[model samples]
Target: MRGIPLQKTLWHLGVLWRKSPLALSPEARTGLWKMSAPASTFDIFLSHTWHTPGKWKILSLFFQSGWRFSFLGWFVGASLMLLASTHKLLPLFIPYRSNFDGATISCGAASRCLLGSLLGHGLGLLLSPYAPSACARRPLCFLDVASIHQTDRELMERGIYSIGGFLHVSKELQVLWSAPYLSRLWCIFELAAYRTANPSGRVVLSPLFVECGACICILGAYFAAFLFVFALPLQHFGIYVVYVVGLLPIYVLMHLLRRNILAKHQLFEGLRFFTLAEARCESDFDHDFIHTAIRAWYGSAEAFTAYVQGSLRQELLASKPTTIPLRYLVLLVGVPFGLSLDFLAALIAREAPMEWLLTEFLAGCLGFNLCWFFGSVQIALFLCDRFAAPWRGGLFDYLQTLVLFLIFFGVYFLGSLMASTSNLWHALAVASASLLFAIVTLVCRRAAVGS
Candidate 1:
């Protein structure tokens, strides 16, 4: 019996010694443990909040309708194009209202309402002749939290990388810039992602559709006043013409300067006005990639500039050369004022002679269109520079701005005179200048990359 007990104790002590912490070094012990699982990968990533339950409903509706989903910008551009061509007053003024209650799940969340409303409008517009069909095929809608499997940590980690990828490849970005959207940390990241993807401008502002249309319509009212309300002579009406047509370019130019200031100061990237208020209110998420990106952006002006240049250089070398979107080119560049040509003619035609009418119309159209294009080129160049290097400095940026200003101003100054000549020669002058400016812009962008 004593021998048996001693043998059992010795065996127990041996087992304890084998399992003791002193048996192996810390590194060796860690080496014996299993590692964490590698993150899962996916082709697409959607980024959004878990609180937005309505998004799932919207996603269901999208699939059930047998219609394809695309980015919001393509649809908005097509919608605007169609609305403009139809010469309809309804689409411009009428707000697109959705059947579903956007706020049903999320109280006071305006983005939910906007998402539903815009999708509804886009679905209706897709049936139209002018809708962008290319966007509909193999439609991929990335709705943040819905797209990622939250229960799986690996999937979520991989989803983060996919966010940047989807943003870069998406045909359009429809942003619902509500208070919640601006306040959320993820929303700002979405914006930065889209801006980097389409630096030449496919980033559509969902709210701007009606607002810009209304602004144009209001401008039309002023034109109508000159036509019917209080008749003014052609010469006097030209004052209003200059004021109206000129305001757009000036606004755009001033906007460029303001945005450049923001980007330079590292306050925000791309379109700052849309998210400024919300960004200020955004909750601190220390571990977020978005914050890391922001920190990298703020590290040092020179360091950030070099990093941007490196990124842009890599992008430029790898892909096709960057070209401005035709939609943005037409919309923001030269089309809005061109469309106003007929209305302008109508306003002054009633009060002026045929010669004066033709001259003013032609000249106004040419001048404004040229101005719009000039302003657009300036905008594009500035964006290119900003994208290439946010904190870019030295003589190049200044020289580029000064050169652009002088060239456009000279063209405008000459175009205004040629317009008043009543020979329609101003169109030719504007055409030549615009072509030259465009060529210069393309060349300059290339040069930026080369340097």
Candidate 2:
């Protein structure tokens, strides 16, 4: 009788346990609900979230399917642009805060952006030929504006003293040499200190004048595009906008080419170097290392007669002038306006309306004129260098430059005369005029080199 009851009780307990597979506690049920709830917005990547390890695998699989065939196939470019604008790519090797007492001039604005770009693109300019990327863990940059402590007199003094060491060890020294740089006593000291420390070191000069011109050109292009988009009649605004959009990449290419031309043709404009201690009075800049060292050491003008002499020589020996090809000149002249002579000619022929062709011609004229102005400026700078002999430093150079202008003017006058009231001829004439000038300049340069 006792065995029969015990077997019956065990069967009942087994049946109840099978009915409730998991007899969870109330607290356990609540904890599970909380864990399974939706994640916060912060945890999502472009609205995809992973609450657990398995969910991460699911997300990855989903991403793999759609990664390649996306909008514009430029997702990587967009990502990079975003990263660059945020300055996430430029890791701060040395963290520094602005210590200037009056105003905060940190590299957050255009200066910072340009510096960051130079760091990435122009690292070779700053680095020695044999220098290894990882030989020094830290960036060997001396941001004088950003590095020193402003309030502490003792710290500032120490920073000033170490300026020489910084200049001495630096492979390249870049001087902005703007009005503010000239006015600041400390900034002048830094320049002087660099010369004192390294008589033979490479110094890169950032001429504000040329940089400003480039900036102005960029701003003007943007403004023109903007104005065209809004100021035009709404009937064909979309078409004009498309044209503007097409011109943007070309403008960038043109700007890069122009900069390369300037760098290749003229590095030291309105400046000079002298062989002996003495130089002409009107030379814009002269390098005298002994005088520089003396002035830096003593902070007095007693050791030097003239601050601006042609005695300062460029560290690098001048190389033979390389002849730029015709195709490059054509691109530099035409690319900025998205100009295709064949396309324009075909369009004019197909349209065959006086108003339309005239309009196009006028537009082409404007583009060609602007290109001519810029091209002439570049050629002028190039020629200015050729005429910048030590003996021809002062009034002689000024007179020679006038002659250069006369030559350009004469060419333009002759081209205009040839165009002479014919519409097609006029358009061709303007472009040929500018092209002719560039060609002649190049020819002259090549001849000079040959001699």
Q: Per-prediction TM-score, please?
A: 0.37, 0.36
lDDT of 1: 0.39
Model 1 worst lDDT window (10 residues): 1-10
Candidate 2 stretches with Cα past 4 Å from truth are: 1-140, 151-154, 218-300, 305-310, 313-335, 339-436, 442-451
Model 1 over residues 1-451: C-alpha lDDT tens digits?
Answer: 0001111111222221133223546553343222211223222223333223333323222322222222343345434543443343322221111111121111110112122223433454234222344533333445443343344567656755667666665555555322244455566566656656556534433321222222232233234322321222235677577656654554345334433333222322332333222343223552355657745544643443444345532432242222222233332332234333433323332344444445445445544444534444554345534543423566565554545545545654554454443344554455455556656755675555455
Could you tell me which 10 consecutive residues in candidate 2 have the lowest summed lDDT? 1-10
Q: Give the best candidate by lDDT.
A: 1
**Tens digit per residue, CA lDDT, model 2, 120-203:** 222321222223434322222343222333344575557545666666655556543322333333443455566667676665
After superposition on all CA atoms, how large is the RMSD of candidate 1?
Answer: 20.9
